[model samples]
Target: MAAKDDLGRVGEQRAAAYLSDRGYDVLDRNWRCPAGEVDIVASRAGLLCVVEVKTRTSLRFGHPFEALDDRKVRRLWHLAHAWIDAHPGRAVHSRVRLEAIGIIGPDPRSGMLEHLVDLR
Candidate 1:
């Protein structure tokens, strides 16, 4: 894998650990459907969260979250719905929402992680 891909993988793993430590039950990771992909799927307080993770070595251009535009958010939503359809038992009667994680550091595992509940 590319260095960039490795960073992202570590960032996603860090994001998952962050959620798990905070009492959220992680249902999936790197979930994909015909529509697209979701970085993380977790639940807490009867709510299902679809998380988009962006990792970068530095913020030379912008924050990691800046990578996601309106188009990407729309695609994430589409992917979330597709995930729900594919996992009926898991997402049954649940309220789904979009979220994001941004990581910036030389080592993503030790990077600064930020969580945004809004993608719009």
Candidate 2:
């Protein structure tokens, strides 16, 4: 369990860096409310991006993205709104958008990172 958690943390860190490099201002990370947790929340060019990151040590079961099912996506949406509610005025001039990231490798530090923007 610890190893899995460590990998997730590293993956999220990598995702955050990638976003920052692309000019996204990170607002929140691992934010949780009654609905669920949001992996990363950022703002870029008047768009508030809610990012969900999935990390896998291997593809033995499936690709990292395979873990994000419909239910998970729905939960992320709920969490995104909850985040907006929590941080007033942050979304006033920004549109909400969903983003996803998948990291795959034996070690998260050297993982292959793939990012998808504006997921419906």
Candidate 3:
């Protein structure tokens, strides 16, 4: 894989581990369709979370979360619904939420991880 792709995979793995540590049950990773892709799908406390993970090696470009703009957010929302539709057996009680996990630096093991919940 390309360096950037590998970095993103590492970041996603880190994000999954972080969520797991926090008591969230990770259901899926890299869930995709014609609409778009969701980095992670998890459930916790009756909330269905659709996660978008952004990873960067440095701040020279910008914070990883900066990539999730209005357009991207809309796409994520659609993707979340698509995921739900595809997985009818999954039960969601509270509601579906958009989340973002940002990783900065190459080593996700020690890199800075910022998780932003309920993105608009």
Best by lDDT: 3
**Candidate 1 regions off by >4 Å?**
none
lDDT (C-alpha, whole model) for all candidates? 0.88, 0.88, 0.89
Model 3, span 50-112: residue lDDT tens: 999988888999998789899999999899889998998984546999999988876876799
Per-residue accuracy of model 2 over 1-120 as CA lDDT, tens digit each: 798899999999999999999999998899988787899999988888999999998889898777778888888888888898898977664488999999999888798888988677
Give the winner by TM-score: 1 or 2: 1
Local accuracy of candidate 1 as per-residue lDDT tens digits, 1-120: 998888989999999999999887999999877777789999988888999999988999899887789899889889988989899888964588889999998999887899997667
Instruction: Find the 10 residues in a row with the least total lDDT in model 2.
Output: 87-96
After TM-score superposition, the amount by which residue 3's alpha carbon in candidate 2 deviates from its true location, in angstroms, is 0.5
RMSD of each: 1.1, 1.2, 0.9
- Deviation of model 1 at 28, angstroms: 0.7
TM-scores, all candidates, are 0.95, 0.94, 0.96
- Better structure of 1 and 3 per lDDT: 3
Ten residues in sequence with the least summed lDDT for candidate 3: 85-94
| Model 3 pairs in collision | none
lDDT of 2 at 89: 70
CA displacement after TM-score superposition, residue 104 of candidate 1 (Å): 0.4
The number of clashing residue pairs in each candidate reads 0, 0, 0
